[model samples]
Target: MQNERATDTQAALGTDTAPAGIYIHVPFCRAKCPYCDFYSVTDSDRIPNFVDALLKELKRRRGRVPSADTVYFGGGTPSILTPGQIERILGAVHDAFNMMPDSEVTLEVNPGTVSLDSLHGFRNAGINRLNIGLQSTNDRTLGFLGRIHTAEQARNTYRWARQAGFDNVGLDLIYGIPGQSREAWRAELADVTRLKSEHLSCYTLTLEPGTPLADRVNQGRIPSPDEAVVGDLFVFTCKWLDDHGYRQYEISNFARQDPGKGIDLRSRHNRKYWNFVPYLGFGPAAHSFLDQCRWWNHRNLAAYLADVAAGRLPVAEKERLTRDQQLIEAIYLGLRQTDGIDTVDFRQRFAIDFFDYFRKAMVPLIDGGLIQLASRRVRLTAQGMRLLEHVADVFIQALE
Candidate 1:
């Protein structure tokens, strides 16, 4: 049933036909999450300048990309930008790139930063998809996570999106927090699922180094999330979501299948990142990848602005992946999704037999029931999904 459901999801998404994607990183935020390490600033004063620089950067990269089928506005909080600003940026995107008529345009929004009117404005401004950052439905958990919005506020945000005429909406949730219980986490999922969101991104909270949460954990102010408990929660989440009519396409993402409604809620832009499809990113701290080369812009907003003003790309550094590096990435990224890697495609791309090349690594993993090799493809077993990092390490070591 698991494999069949996963296969059905891959067919519905048709990721193979998605040519490319464009990502616009909005670096402005009202406040930062204590557990987040993504580059973002609390200064709204710099937004106007940032918008101008972003446009310049977009213009400078015209004709350097393929016709894009998806555009994603990701951020510290893209909702902080007015609807007018979002529309202006999107207009530039349409003019500069060969945007598909049916391209999926998504905007990441946080509760408390937007209203029903704003959401309506966003819908009219070409944002066909909405991903709300509602990390928890529990008020106490919201406070512990340093979220600016309350539980009621998050509920209102979802309600407003629907009222604003957004048919495809996704919700983001975090689990495995310090001191959180299994029953509590289950209750959180039950609460959000009852809202009937078209998509869900349930991520296990990570205590990233240098973040406030990590500092507290290191100082013994709070205990780190129990690995065993976290693992159990991960397994439970997959099963719970599966039984709830949501398909797990990627490790952290699930989408509802509604053929009757013609809604495949999988995130097209994000699929590019997992499948190695080419993409171009604009704005401070954005990353781009194409034809085996990956590059990123300056993380410092000042440097990015200055570079764009001087008619130069704000690229900080870039590298072309070697064959070995590409192979490693292929294995690592492929295993993270349900579809896994196509052995035949891998062989054709690299001119090496997949089984012969990774015999040592494949044997033990298959023996241990961590992975399965069948139907000319490789994929993780349900048990293997929870230990994804460790499984990837086994493959990485074989390459070494």
Candidate 2:
């Protein structure tokens, strides 16, 4: 029954129009992080077959290929794929899609798995940007996070990436671990700054349900950090990064230099998500958004391959956004960036003044120092950014 429903959803959303971005999910990992719930398997026994299936699926969807400005290879660890496989997939992308000459192509890598040769191959394969998962510079915290790479390993990989001719490199870091301290967080930042990366994404560790971290908390095996401590750390992050010339472009993202200079670079692919630009996703657990509807491919790899091999679309679920839903999402997503929400664009898109549409909602947020309205634009204040989820809840309730 679920399969039938998924097929129906795919039929409804599938269309031949240019997309803003293309996202390919590589669902294979060397090891699954204890806190990760993303669909990925550690075993490499079926990797070759899976890659073949991915290529087949790409071919099947070629007719619907859209001009894309960005192509993102995100995964359990895209670096796990052999250079030859990566090359083949990229070749298929270029052949099928209308890619811009200066289009940003990115691959997510794990520092421990990356080598100079691999980085070079990825660049040769047309990957212009790399996002390395350097969750923490502290080995002890890294171990706690189930990350395989050490701080030195991450630094070495970053250096090699530069040598491999990748000017636009981004690093991912996480803070607010169970036993983390402000000084420790600062030291992590210090280590990251030395890399002089174009972009840096620092995130607070959340105990997601169904993950080992969450289980530990549930069983009283670990005590999660207090909310006050977490809040303090967030505030410290903003000030500290800014002081170091890493401006906060989004709530958790900081850039050291101009994006064009390979500093302060934004994730062009992810920006599509925040800006609600249309994108097409491929492979198992991939997602697509278009014509006000969102849909996802099957999470189960075997099922995805079987359906695709049979020349069937493997979509698993979808939703068509209502007018209210779209409006709410626009507010929620747009306000996440430091650039804030453009009132003119909102009016042009929805035929309503954003301020007028949600005067009541804006009033309290403004008073609470959570938002600022200026020149017909609205944006989250630093304090407001801290409580982004809470603000989103208020917006949702207002719609209700």
Candidate 2 residue runs with Cα over 4 Å from true position:
1-19, 63-65, 259-264
Query: Model 2, range 175-254, lDDT digits (tens) per residue?
Result: 88887889989998888887788888988888888988889989999998677788889989999888887888888888
Clashes (backbone N, CA, C under 3 Å), per candidate, total 0, 3
User: Candidate 1: which pairs clash?
Assistant: none
lDDT of 2 at 328: 73
Query: In candidate 2, which residue pairs clash?
Result: 198-263, 198-264, 257-263
Show model 1 residue runs off by greater than 4 Å: 1-18, 259-262
Worst 10 residues of 1 by lDDT: 1-10
Candidate no. 2 TM-score: 0.92
TM-score of each: 0.94, 0.92
TM-score of 1: 0.94
Candidates in order have lDDT scores of 0.88, 0.82
